[model samples]
Target chain A: MKYNAAFNPSGGAAIVGLGMTEMTREYSYSATGLAGIAVKRALDDAGLKKEDIDGLFINAGVTNAISTPLQTSLGFRDLKLLNHMNAAGSTAGQMVQFASLAIQAGMASHVVCVFADDPLKPGTSAGAAYGGTSNRSTGMASLPASYGFFSGANTSYALAARRHMGLYGTTQDQLGAIAVSTRAWATMNPAAMQQKPMTLDDYHGSRWIVEPFHLLDCTLVSNGAVAVIVTASDRARDLKQPPVYIAGMGQGHPGNPRQAGYENEVNTGARIARDTAYSMAGVGPDDIDIRELYDCYTYTTLVTLEDYGFCEKGEGGAFVEDGKLGPGGSHPTNTGGGQLSGYYMWGMTPVSEAVIQTRGQGGERQVQTRDHVLVSTQGGILDWHSTLILSPNADAGTRN
Target chain B: MTNQDQAVRPAPIVDESSKPFFDAAADAVLLLQRCNICHAYLWPFREICTECLSTDLSWAPSTGKGSVHSFVIMHRLFHPAFQEDVPYNLTVVQLDEGPRVTSIIRGTANEDIHVGMSVSANWHDVNGTPLLHFEAF
Candidate 1:
């Protein structure tokens, strides 16, 4: 891929703090309240006061519960930058990317990126929050819903997975390998929700939500919040925790026309985002030691691995069939069990894990070689994509 | 459950941009938006041509033939209206005109549906509203 000079935000910023609330299916607080706690925790983690944070970037989940008012609710005054971003799962990486650029441009010194949601409501099924039809039953919106195409992401991703399976012969067991491997990693992480050992048989026996997707293939529905503080790389060295350098940042939004010859279902925006991120980081896929990908579904992980060039586009199923992504495997992906088994805080699930692993704070789940980590966040039905290459070494990549 | 107690299935509430499509559906005709300037076919009803940004568009009758591009068997009940239709085939048909439409495939079992299977557009009624569906050919 050709390198673009204007896209270089490498080594300009670093994550200095991380904060998260307990992941749970029961709702204990509003999304704003959770965000406030997370921001406070992050400030304490970074050993900084609330006054030190001049920038705030907020991303709300399905509920759209958290927004710009979070700054005021947190008693933040005179913030230099404050914006609510929503690129779906890609918002976290987009927040970090914008924070890096803003810090590099001298717009703000310390920025906080937070995502919070309380999608799990009382007396509702786990899928209800996401399954509800928000679209008006009129015009083009009603067309899909009128035909029993109700569940939003579940239906869309199942269709995409089916297409991939049809085109490339991807099997159900191949997808099960992802769920099993991610579950294995979840057993090691204390913060993970599903720590019970899961086997391929367990995955196969799981109830089918959609034809191509088993129940285990879907992510958990948790109510929680995650926050990270970003600042200049030079200043991060003096912070309380080891700085996770932002080596590269890139985003891609490839609109789906929902027509033939478009191929958005199989060919995702991750390919374009990967090229930009790899170019900015001055490293190839071989250089990364850990992959903290956004695994909203098992098929997502498989397709992302292929899109990131870990394997050929159509060969992801065969590549992961041998348990390569589990513990003690060649490739350590979703080291924190990802959103599937981990807390589903959207993109923050992968971003937080990448930061933890890079800072050597992963405890038992940490990879030995944590020099370089690749974090990916996908939004919509593979429509939006963002990639981040984080490293322990501040000088790992070429400086702008 | 009695018929009156059954949940009502959702029907398309047509708007200005999609009025013509639903109007054509009432006559059992599959109509797609086409740009007069670029002659590009648009799906899901669009005001302007995506290729040439031309607003001079009109609905034209389609060949009503296509192939199943992809499909899924929805096992879980996401909506109460479709309670009895669990494990039904929700298919995406790739029209020969180059656009894809989401509809249920009739006259075939869920297991029988496969990619590239030939299908033709057909109309079904929901609460007296006509909706487009496909039947395997």
Candidate 2:
């Protein structure tokens, strides 16, 4: 991967604080309320007052809640930078990237990026909440829906996963390996939603939501918010918590033309995001000690590992079949159970865990090495991707 | 419950740009947008050709033949209109013309559908709405 310029933002910014609301299926608070609480908690965690936050970025969830008005609700005034971001599930990493660039460019001294959502209702099933029948069938959108091709992430991801399976001979058991291993790590983390022990048999026995995707393959839906504070790496050293240096950041959006020759399902945007982040961080996949990947589905984890150069592309099935992503495995992926077994807060699910592991705060599930951590966030049906390479050492990446 | 009590599936919202495609569907013909300049085929009815950005486009009849690029058996009902259609296969067919269309694949069991299976389009009407489906050829 070659670049025209030698400029790199690695080690220019750092995350000094982390805050999160309780992950729950049904909570009383609204999305804005959750964001307010998360922001307050983050400010407290960083030992800074609201006035110290010169920048604010908000990422709303599926409900379209939380926006610039959150600053008024949080009583923030005279901010140098504020915007609402939407890259779907990849917004968390994108927010951090923008905040890092802003701080490095002296646009804002301290920036807070927050994401919150309240998708779970009191009595409705998670499927109903996410797969509501409100999709408009008129116009161009109606063509697919008219054929009973309704809008839902499950169906789209299932199609993608099936294509990968057909092309690479990836088996259901390979996907089961990811679900089982992620559950193993979830059991060790008290914060994880599904802490019960899961096995390959249990995964296979789980009810099928879509063919090629069992219920266990899906992620948990929860109502929660997560926020992080970013500032210059030099100032982060004087903060209340250990600074997790933002070593490298990159985003990729592979437009899906949906043509015959386009293989967006088999090949994702993570490949480009990986190259950009790796080039900026000046490190290869072997240098990272922990992987906090966005596991919206078990298949996503497998494909992401392959795209990030952990293994050859078509060999992800065999790579994960040996249980290498579990608690005591060579690659400690989704150490906090990931979105599959852990709480789902979009990209924040992985970003928050990356911060904890980089700070050496993952109590029971923390990896032995805390030097470098790689975090990935994916949005849409393998359309958008963002990568973040975090480290405890401020001088981790090579400065250009 | 009587047939009248059954929930009617939502109709496709049609506008100026998509009216021609739906009009062609009403005639049981699979029509696709093609650029007059670059001769590129476009799906879902677009004003300009994606290949050459040409507004000079026209609707052309297709052979209605394609292969299953990928598919999924939807076990859970996402909409009430699909209450009786649970466990149906929602398939994406790579049309022989070069574009992909997402529709249901009929005349075959859900387990029988696989990638690269040859299929041909099947048009039907439901609640006064024309829908395009595919069947194993």
Candidate 3:
């Protein structure tokens, strides 16, 4: 129940394991099968038996929200310790943190956090839905008497970006810079959806999915699952690898999904969520060396970096343009090719990279040496969100 | 509210949870937002008004008109269920009463649309009652 201000988690409740199925939308396997494959792999990585897991945290997939895959996966009949934490879209880092907490709290010896998605509706393109999901359910008719919502993720952010551009004089190239650098990072990540190097010319030349957020600025979507395990900090001490602690956690929902011609950062969920996580971890945005943000949309990552306390509220567009989040940059992100470049597996794949980075396992895109990492998770997976800061020390108190 | 009487006006499938919303949509007039302490004109009827952060909201009428603040054309439908509506245009129109509502844009061609254009309310007779869409003036 107590944590030390300097408690290093290098051997505490670390991620002893990780697993992921290939990213694709055309798979015939059920969502459960996908999760099981990933879960088994995570356990294998942890060097633990399936029975060692005592807690369950599930994100069956965004499209699988109302589905039965969460329970059916793992083929578990004799379920023991289960913590059903459902903050959709914020991330796989949340899952890892959930496992870490279950261990720290003694609720379970080891927790298997499984999330997978066939996010792409079958026969459709191999893609994932960005920050928003169409809320229409069958059998119900839309009210015919007045104006209804026609907005989706792109338009939603466009309004905000337009206001930012209008108020702060933000530019298309500032936005374009993010896409360029993100594409550059994606080339390094084989799993990212867009791996080809993108230039400002390519960014400007790309077709617009929504005005301002052209094809290049958008993130790609795919199908895949990423899972991991966290055991008692004591048990982690003897593991084959080092450990990463859940230093902090945060999640959020926009106060208003639409922009009312005003661009106020606090109205957005980033600062609120970031503050809570920082308070929990005792660290500031300047402390972390790496970030695994949800890049379901280009602005998704750009805006989040600002919201996570990395820079002044409106400065995200400028932050990424400077190459700070690229290879060999001060604070790198999506090293394995984010949803933008790599596969779009419901944004959880980035969390796996966070684990790898914290474990110093990122091969080429790896930070020089990651003693600390901040993993941000989000998407339209429930109109939800969350951020988890992981460290090599478990007992270290807050970082801020 | 009865078994035999159900035949006359079939019991609404939506319960206390969805009745108010369906009722407003059925009426063609959007509902005003209400708070636990004050039942005020909260446009875009919601479960709770952000004003008081209270769940005690009641339905009220809203002036169904606004300007098109923003939009999207959904050039393609991600799911086959929406195939017929492919390339449908969606817009965020701020209502006269203040809530910004988004829905399909009608009464205008995609080529004619532009920022700051004036738009008004046009109910879409989707099925049971009028569903709100938009028209540019």
Candidate 4:
């Protein structure tokens, strides 16, 4: 009994609206200002009012830690079903999963999934994320920290890259291609952070921050918010625009925090999540025109090609070369530029891209031909990953 | 609470869940692994036993004996904070009690560290606190 999004599929739930605020490193507005802008735009896109909303999904950072109802914040007294999930960065994908489950369960008529930041307030530091330093450790700071094996996210990635380079013989150029293609994709996106086209030489010439990984391989954090609205598929047809049917979605935690980011789980995890989505949408990986794996870093996208079953393990390094993940290639990942160049709301862009691809509205960055696109969500440093399958129409899994 | 000194700040510190280990480290006697079901040797201290998974674990003294299971030279510094310690030795020493303890292989160059070599624990007290480092037997 394969669970399809149509049979047990979340057919009723559809993303009817989307919204986002500008990404800025400096504080132009408070996090609430960014969150309000995004939430307001999503409501506007859905053609719905503040009082019309029944549920809210809020994430916290400098721009977003507060979990308040829309009515309370915007001067209304009639909002219900508030859901707050705090993931490191994969808040967007996590919110979608929560919303889908809530909507499918008939808990809310309208669900708003949001990612906003308030984590960067003045008089405060980047906290534990700068390093693997967590407030929740009783194991006595070990050699990994005392020896400085991992002082920050950059160093942690460096440690993992060393192992990956040692194990799979992944080349520096292969890593650069991941950065290059994302920057190329970012060139097509107007709202992207770094939209300039970069060459392989440019990537090589870039300053090497950590060993193997250069400056281009890292993600930039900004103060902003991105939001989406979901309603049942039944109401999707009656909405102001076409709906991108919720095909399949799943999430997972990493077995090893230190080594999880390099697991290349895209093949195993994405395969299962996709099988469910394809099982629901009645399509397969061959039917996909786009592949959006959560790419917080360059190696992330590189390792997942094999993880997503696009190629065999140890082949992702080679398969990524020569315009493979590029626009003309079979799979175009990070079309919205990815975290490397685009707005990274924790796999948010890919979710929006899936909607855009299915609706055939990804202006300038649209794939020539596509259907049953798979969107992946990351939990943190690849410590966890999730998958969601989307399509233009309803796909109920047929009993074989 | 206030740091007025440039080199160091003199402030009374408080401890909640980690006072005992600190005191034991002050004694230079490493005690981490614990057995709830049966009293035995342990290296890495935890509330639950890896052997029994029982929540009843108490830290005890160790003989400070182990062997190197695997090691990495790390020609590159893992942290800018430890830049002076570049090319540091990192190893997974399988304790005599069977718990693998991870630590820096000090008093030896990176190339000098080898697998299956006999090793003993050496706790380097930093800031009046013992930070675990190891030496070859």
Candidate 5:
């Protein structure tokens, strides 16, 4: 659903708590088990009890029927709101928007948004497990599979990276800048998976998963989960942790699958979503203090930088050069190492990182100004996208 | 060999909407659906026009010539049948008629393939199933 702040123009709802389980290469637990751990951690961090949670929003695609099992485990007898979303990786931000709507409408007082998955676990179907699976029996999969295009994201995104290079002279080195910078942040973050500092030489020498993409350019398939708590901005002030206001948010999808599925390397739904989010937040790109972009691939961040108006179209390559996104750089992006170096909780990785930054919990990698944080999440080869602007102040409106 | 035993690669599962496209591909012709009313080309198989939302559509033969819009050399195998073709290049061909189609770029090394390179349609037979592919023009 489209997010209209006019219903509660003063930013009524805010995220008061953020938590996560250990982000490791492999976690030995059921998907539900991990989700429960994350939910409890978020509640504990918020200093709230299980009974205080009246609503639950979860990443439905991770585990089937997660709400009932989680609610039962947490000892909540009744829930005023429940949602299970399957928008690939974009569900994290979408769930937050849904939870905020519930609180504003009085359907629930406290809502928990959670994402837990074990894509790297044993005995899992390789392609169908992640965002790149095709039906093989219908739609876009039939034609592509005939040509041996059966793998997930690595191929689809590599094609996009190559298209960008061909059209705008984006070089492989420019893409390496993103990987190198994210790894620099990961060195400071204790929870990151790929902890060893990655240099430009290491990025170039990494295994070539696809022509334009190196192994390091891709996100680590670590098994982990992250969760956050959402409640009214007024109620949040009385809670334990400081409130991170949901200043503005928006979700966008190409009107038709044909547009999203065909010739999609050049454009995506993020272009439309970013415009709405910035307009609603009353802030321009210059006003954003930091960015927590969904980094499924190095090129995804590059294209998002252009689509979100951080820089002009076809200039993201040049824009990211010279360690611009590093710790001491002007634009501090993905403060928590992001999915590329940190654990891959799909879209939740970016959301969790942004929440931590906005809460001033990002110890070493925190941006100087944690006031206006912009987070972007995407699903289905940029087919679906959502942008969220967060702040530490309840009324963080940039209208001046 | 029986159908199941002879299948070495994933074959297109034909349904009511996509049967014609596969049928034409098997005969060494590339067919793209065009809305008879809006005159817009549609990919994969759609019953109605995406542009103007018209149901009047017809199967039209394409020249099957286009430039390489983008491509990837898939080093990882997602399916058992693709193990033999590991490190093969899959390219998206921007057809001159306006729709983009995915096909394996044959007759060239994966490292040599470049975007915007001209390619023409050809047929690749896999376990008796014929499919469309492209070769350097």
Candidate 6:
């Protein structure tokens, strides 16, 4: 149960290349097909062939076993490592962390991490696609349904948002600010799903999916896949694409520990994971040039902003209202729209955007300063959390 | 009464740990598991006390009263069973005894229900299957 930091390789790992399929509302390709194409694109982006990938990591909600089909398609003969991680929206960040650890352990030199899903397709139940069978029986399975109180991600998040409002007097206006700002960022990214401008009035006018949550507050359930190639920092320098170093990464579940329902909604697992990531990266919140927070719901982004020390516990409302996260704001966040307006590749959207920005490939929506980027990912009703600090150089954020 | 809507509603499959809870609910009685050692009460039944890890756990009749910790009014039909039940309120009740229970609040419109409002447990007869719900105190 003890982890010795000395065991980790000194050089650190870096994301050498990134690729993803077109973010579509309804994609005709199978999940495996989308994943294979993304993997090949990532390999091509790194200027490497299939033979160059020695490891493979896959995350697709409950269907983590799709690695076999990907390996079959890619024809990876000398694969040295393979792992199937399922941390809900935290999958992308967690997979990248695993890939880094695998390289650091000498288990593999090159790892291709991927996340793909198509929840918008006909007959795709949210439970089957994201909750998994075990997830269905976890929270609200006993009695909530009998009274017509069935559960899902949006409903659960709405409940948490209500608690925050009640506890700290957080207004719908504050939540609207996040939704509005997210759309502004989305409009700048061509890969985003909803690019239309959304103002405070527009957010208020949007219909309610669950009270305390307007339609605009929810994330798009689009069909897409995102992939990234990770290798040793030294090796990444020689690759074709600019390397986004894995400066710091951490994961933890501080809420609901081992329980069924989410014990605490307003505060979440991000608190612990946030500190761990910053400590490992040898950086603080002020050092971050850009933030790609998981925006599965508008409140999610708000809460994470508070948890990660971007603002006070209940001050997220005023912080976002000041236009810090919007275009031309001091702290540019989710420049690629994130899951809110961006393609909902779950957590992979954050990872892809982080890599793109650090490499100076964010086109029109790119941040002014791209030295340090922070990405946060969450899973399962705000229970599981993972955070990553990516930088433009291997020693970008290293402690002196 | 015929259980016409039994198939659509999520039924709690009675098991060794949860049987007593459903049996009590059948009689409109709310039962929660209490640790015989640490005197801690828990929901979503477990064999051992979640607090003390003591196997000596027993069912205790609850006062069936608590306060709203949080709630949400569903505007979307997550499943077909709730097609006609759109806009129903789902709530988390922080029981007086300390454990939180997921239930629905009664006798209040979705707009009226708020956190910290007192709620009391009641029976929800889904076909013949009795389930637990709550009402404003």
In candidate 1, position A31 carries an lDDT of 98
Which candidate order results from sorting by TM-score in descending order? 1, 2, 6, 5, 4, 3
Please give each candidate's TM-score.
0.96, 0.95, 0.77, 0.79, 0.90, 0.91
Deviation from native of the Cα of residue A309 in model 3, angstroms: 2.1
> In order, what DockQ does each candidate have?
0.77, 0.69, 0.14, 0.19, 0.52, 0.48
- Which window of ten consecutive residues has the lowest lDDT sum in model 5 chain A? A1-10
lDDT tens digits by residue: candidate 1, A150-249 = 7778889999999999999999999999999999999999999999999989999999988899999999989999999999887788889999998887
lDDT of 4: 0.65
Worst 10-residue lDDT window for candidate 6 chain A reads: A131-140
The alpha-carbon deviation from the true structure for residue A30 of candidate 5, after best TM-score superposition, in angstroms, is 1.2
lDDT of 6 by residue, A268-301 (tens): 7788887888988888888889999999888998
Task: List, residue by residue over B1-137, the lDDT tens digit for candidate 6.
Answer: 24455336766666666777877877888888888899888777676777778999888998988899888887866666776767788888888887888778878988889889998888867767787778888
CA lDDT, every model vs. true structure: 0.89, 0.87, 0.64, 0.65, 0.81, 0.80
Candidate with best DockQ: 1
Native-referenced DockQ of model 5: 0.52
Which is superior by TM-score, 4 or 5?
A: 5
The sequence of per-residue lDDT tens digits that candidate 5 reaches over residues A1-400 is: 2112223434468898787989765547767878888888998999988878878887844434365566666566678787677888889999998888777776677889988877656666434566454555564456677667755577888888998998899999999999999999999999998879989999999988777899889987766678899988877888899888988888878653443245445566778888888887888899999999999899999998888888988999999988899899999998889989988888888999998899888887778787799999888787788989999976785421
Model 1: residue A89 alpha-carbon error in angstroms: 0.8
Docking class of 2: medium
Question: Looking at the true structure's interface, with contacts defined as alpha carbon pairs within 8 Å between chains A and B, what fraction does model 6 recover?
Answer: 0.48
Proportion of true inter-chain contacts also present in candidate 1: 0.84
**What TM-score results for chain B when candidate 5 is compared with the true chain B?**
0.89
- Scoring model 2 with DockQ, what do you get? 0.69
RMSD of 1: 3.8
Q: Candidate 3, which segments miss by more than 4 Å at Cα?
A: A1-12, A65-79, A83-85, A120-122, A126-167, A254-267, A381-383, A393-396, B1-37, B46-70, B73-89, B95-98, B103-137
CAPRI docking class of candidate 1:
medium
The sequence of per-residue lDDT tens digits that candidate 5 reaches over residues B100-129 is: 787888999888888889999999776676
lDDT of 4 by residue, A1-400 (tens): 2111233233446788888888765566665667789888988877777766777877765344557654366553444567667665556677887777776776666778877774445554443335434432344534355554543556545544544555577788988888888888888888888888899999888766555567787776656778888877776666676776676666655443111122432333454455555665566667767887777678777766666677777777888877778776777887778778887666676777677677787788888676567787765545666777766766533311
